[model samples]
Target: MEPTNEDYTYRAGDIVYVFYRNPHTQDVANIQEAAVVNNPENPNELAVFLYETYYPLTNEMAVYSTEEEAEQAYHHYFGGI
Candidate 1:
């Protein structure tokens, strides 16, 4: 998923991770993980926009290609998500 801030650590083409919600329970039980990859065929805006748009309900703290990096960034901002 995309980071809320424009100047974020993650970028297009990165394997963004998002902990999506369980629609049924509305809880943080489900994971809406996805890769925010940029497709050359589409516009840059459209490519990046999909990441966040797809998982709007996710309590996404941070996004990175690697799990290790993701955790660090996630907690750094959210303190613990």
Candidate 2:
């Protein structure tokens, strides 16, 4: 599980930040900026588009509304900037 903004409500066109791990370099990770959009397969659900992929939006994801917030969280969790 990952940290989430309990008070935040997801909406389409919103920009979000998330921790994205490199597929080829499993040990490397970075904060990625993503866009919130309605799920193409399920309009009622929300998804995030990042790295040419669509990930379902859920509380289990560490989602941040601002870059500062995501950076703080990344530092706290990974202990690096």
Candidate 3:
């Protein structure tokens, strides 16, 4: 068995590589969720939440600025993701 999309688990702030479908093509984006500012709650988790404007619209993954920044983004975006 392979990892399905549903297998991805996201946390508050973590940098991720998101693969999404563009208008007529496939695109990949780097995103970072607002949650994992510092260290992730679960380091073992594959996916994590991010707050990059491009992520939402493009369905790309989150790329973290910094551990602290990621955390701050999480709180700012989701009010404490």
Candidate 4:
């Protein structure tokens, strides 16, 4: 199915694509999507389900505002895989 334009935010329940950097991986940079599940236990950190690790929603990496952008970014990174 095609994706629709939607404004994404850091608020809980919003779907977003988070960019990660790993030296061990094939690509130094990677992108993944997860729902915004804020860690109420700690406001200093951001959390999301289905993610390998808990990363802060900071400016160090990219965060696509919508699923459409995420899909395009994924395809671009994975060579349209």
Give the clashing residue pairs of candidate 4, or none: none
Candidate numbers sorted by TM-score from highest down:
2, 4, 1, 3
Q: Looking at model 3, which ten-residue stretch has the lowest summed lDDT?
A: 50-59
lDDT of 2 by residue, 1-81 (tens): 222356798788999999999999998889999999888988878899998888999888889999999999999998986
Q: Mind giving the per-residue lDDT tens digits that candidate 1 earns over 1-81?
A: 443433454556555555444567773433335755454454333133333453221223434455666566656755765
Q: List the candidate 4 regions with Cα displacement exceeding 4 Å.
A: 1-8, 19-24, 28-31, 75-79
Give the number of the best model, judged by TM-score: 2
lDDT of 2 at 47: 91
Candidate 1 positional error at 72, Å: 6.4
| Per-model TM values vs. the true structure | 0.41, 0.91, 0.26, 0.52
Best by lDDT: 2
**How big is the positional error of residue 32 in model 2, measured in Å on the Cα after superposition?**
0.5
Clashes of each: 0, 0, 18, 0
Which residue pairs in candidate 2 have backbone atoms (N, alpha carbon, C) closer than 3 angstroms, thus clashing?
none
RMSD, every candidate, angstroms: 6.5, 3.6, 13.2, 6.8
Model 1 / residue 40 / CA error / Å: 10
State the weakest 10-residue window (summed lDDT) of model 2.
Answer: 1-10
- From the highest lDDT down, the ranking of the candidates is 2, 4, 1, 3
Rate residue 77 of model 2 by lDDT: 91
Lowest-sum lDDT 10-residue window in model 1: 54-63
lDDT of prediction 4: 0.59
